[model samples]
Target: MIFLMVELMLGVLISVAFISLLERKILSLGQSRKGPNKALFNGIGQPFSDILKLFSKEYFKFSVVSMKFYYFPPLFMIILSFLSCLIFPVVGGFLNMLDELIIYYLCLISVSSYIVIYMGWLSFSKYSLLGSYRGASMIISYEVFLFLLILLMLIYLLSKGQLFNFLTFQSVSGLVLLIYFFYLMFMGVMGLVSELNRSPIDLLEGESELVSGFNTEYLGFMFSLIFMSEYLMVIMGVLFLSGVLVWFSLLGYFVCSLIIVMVVFFRAVYPRIRYDMLMVIFWEIILPFALMFFF
Candidate 1:
């Protein structure tokens, strides 16, 4: 049983990794280029190739970039993501200690923004430095909404029935569940989009302005880890957001996964938003709804 739990985690991790590759393939198709056909199933093996490259990468010490703490961002990000995953209640069984799990999830997901900021500031480039400020500001802006959204879902959950583990929320009253579902779904999508750092809200790292943004100084593996974590966080949001037994709740993930992939593919198809426009949308649109939904 313990082994099965480990296996389950590994399986989902593998699925998340594949999802990243598929996003790349779809993006390639969007850009009028054939994506990785060298690997099985048009680059199914690319993830492994990426892993190999990541291991082979040599860390460079730039005069401007801080080598001392360069390891903390990705390291903490990885630890946090995995730590959050462990508390997600696999197999829906009796729990030994669920309290720590909740705290772990919050701490892990909450500090993720710091990882982005750290990467940006540590780069020591003008672009990276500025990008760090923007990224942190954007994260701070959305975090209030994110917390309010979660609180709203909890309120609806309480109305429906007992507040147990994540999966238990699936057993709520039909009407309440539907309401909770919609609220959670939107918040999850919002979280995913924020992590992606792209337009409609790409102010964090507007590459045209920041010259590759936070990742300007990172090359090879460092760059890959930062990028990988972004996608991973999004996928994690999708998976965790679906942590329930309801068929439609799980179904929402399929829809979200499809939309996220398609959106990523057509990413360049849309024009970037102005930085200030991002602020307006977040403040006027998302925050108001978030505030009202919670209250």
Candidate 2:
């Protein structure tokens, strides 16, 4: 069991890295520019090259930020994102066997956003501070709808006896709740993108506007961790939709690849929304629709 857990996390991490590379490539194509095609073997090794850059680079350990703040920020980010996988039964008809798993997953994923705030607050850079402020407010705005989205799912889950078995979608309830389930899932998907600060919904560190957002002051490996954690949450979103553990390792690869292309296209074509507009869109449009599904 312990071994399986480790493999699961490792697989998730690798999958996320590959997805990041895929996104870069597809977005490059859409923008009519060559993506990362310079690495070993026509950029097949670009992700690894980037990883090496992250591992080999230096981090700022100035006296401005205490060791506690610096260390816990990224650590907690990974911890939170990691725990999200636990709630996902990757295989069909199997239970992850942690009682209160649904509740635990919610708590865990919620903590990831806090870590970003910590990173910015500790960095002592204006851009970092501003990014953190935006991120905090952004999450609060979206989470209102996100929680409603989850509640709707829970309502459906409860209507079906709330069993420990989260897999087994063979239930008639899934069929009965199909419309609501799909609607909630779509909202959840959008919320997941916002939670991870993906493009189209990303406003915190708008590259053109805020200059790398929260981690502008971070060097090498620190940003690497942040970057990985972002993709980690993206994968977590896909895992949340798994609904069964049967796919196990295979499903992780397939869905992540598909999402990479989708997000890449989304980024290539869409302009980032104004911050106020982003908030209003979520609350006015997504939230009410999600609530309607619930009630």
Candidate 3:
């Protein structure tokens, strides 16, 4: 059991590293700039080098910050992010044994929002507080759509006698079903981008305005934990959508890669939207469309 858990953690960590490298490469190409070319194998080693650099730095905390709150939220966030990966159905993997995968996922994500807010508040910085406020608002705005979408999916699946299994969608077939799944995937991508605080949607970490946002005060190993957790959540979100759309196949992996590329592509090409506009996009446009499906 322990070995399996360790294996899962290593796999997630390695994948996170490569995804970071991939994002850098893609962003560089998008901007017509050289990126990470000095590292081993034409920048293949850049992510690991970054990991080392981060861990090697001396740890410090603000005098106003509580040690427990400063340390615990990042660690807890990462652990929850890791646990969410267990919902991915892996062959012979003991960790994916859970039932009602969607419910489990929703619970984890809902909890993570609070952790993000807490982590920010714990930093004792005005920038962090502002970022946390933005983060909470953004999350709350989009999370309702996420919940409704999932509920719609759960209802459709139950109507079809499918008991909330990721693998069950593979056997079901229809134009309506395909269109519905695609809609969910679309909203899932948007929600995940917002939830994970990725580019454009990353108002919580708006560098220009908030100076790294909620994590402004975090550095070194502490920052790395938060960083790793965010990337892991990205992977988990992509995989979840892939499972919904394609199940666990070679094609599913391809789809997952494509989604990751799309995420990086958005980061490369788009500018962050205003927070009010972000709220409008979700509440006015996305939410109504989601409601149409639900009804």
Per lDDT, the best of the predicted structures is: 3
Which of the two candidates, 1 or 3, achieves a greater lDDT against the reference?
Answer: 3
TM-score of each: 0.81, 0.86, 0.91
- Can you write out model 2's per-residue Cα lDDT over 87-175, one digit (the tens) per residue? 65542213456556656666666777777787888888888889999989987888787767656655666787766444432122223
Model 1 off-target regions past 4 Å?
1-9, 64-66, 91-103, 170-184, 196-200, 246-256, 262-269
Residue pairs with colliding backbones in model 1 are none
Model 3 lDDT-worst window of ten: 169-178
How would you encode candidate 3's per-residue C-alpha lDDT over 81-154 as one tens digit per residue? Answer: 88886765543455354556567788898899888899888888999899989877877798998788667766
Q: State how far residue 108 of model 1 sits from its true place (Å).
A: 1.9
C-alpha RMSD for every candidate: 3.6, 3.3, 2.5
RMSD of 2: 3.3
Error of 1 at 44 (Å): 2.3
C-alpha RMSD in Å of predicted model 3 compared with the true structure: 2.5
Model 2 lowest lDDT segment of ten: 168-177
Ranking by lDDT: 3, 2, 1
Task: Give the candidate order by descending TM-score.
Answer: 3, 2, 1
lDDT of every predicted structure (CA atoms): 0.64, 0.70, 0.80
Backbone clashes in candidate 1 total: 0
For model 3, the superposed segments whose C-alpha errors exceed 4 Å read 91-97, 169-184, 244-248
